[model samples]
Target: MNENSHTMSERPHLRVVHGNPTDEEVAALVAVITTLNTRDTPAPPPPRSAWSDRRTLHRPPLPHGPNAWHTSTFPH
Candidate 1:
């Protein structure tokens, strides 16, 4: 008959295997995330009497080329 029917008749259908993880897998993942979040410990605070200096943060300037000024690159 049709080519699609002929191909289907020649090939064997395969069954897909799918299943959910056990409770142990879920608990192990949760324990890993919890350990990661609490791994870093904060240091003690500096002396209250000592005076700290404040400084301004600056970023480097970008290149001024033709492509840098393109209109399509940015949202309208």
Candidate 2:
């Protein structure tokens, strides 16, 4: 054998063997994934018919200004 061949064999080698995952391991992984997928609860809906009476009680004459005749292009 050559001197170079001896040096090549001195390097370390690793061998890894993996087996099938267990059912409990799969269940735990699924639980973690499910937990991550879950989101916070949405805010509750606003009260229905709120300020309905106040809207009807409003009675005021709108002031007609010089710019009032010009239609407002701004969106609501």
Best by TM-score: 2
Deviating ranges (above 4 Å) for candidate 1: 1-19, 41-76
What are the per-residue Cα lDDT tens digits for candidate 2 across 1-76? Answer: 6654535558434222476777887678678867776755566887868567586686554546687545444322
TM-score of each prediction: 0.30, 0.32
The clash count for each model shown is 0, 0
For candidate 1, list the clashing residue pairs, or say none.
Answer: none
User: By summed lDDT, which 10 consecutive residues of candidate 1 come out lowest?
Assistant: 50-59
Query: Scored by CA lDDT, what does every candidate get?
Result: 0.59, 0.60
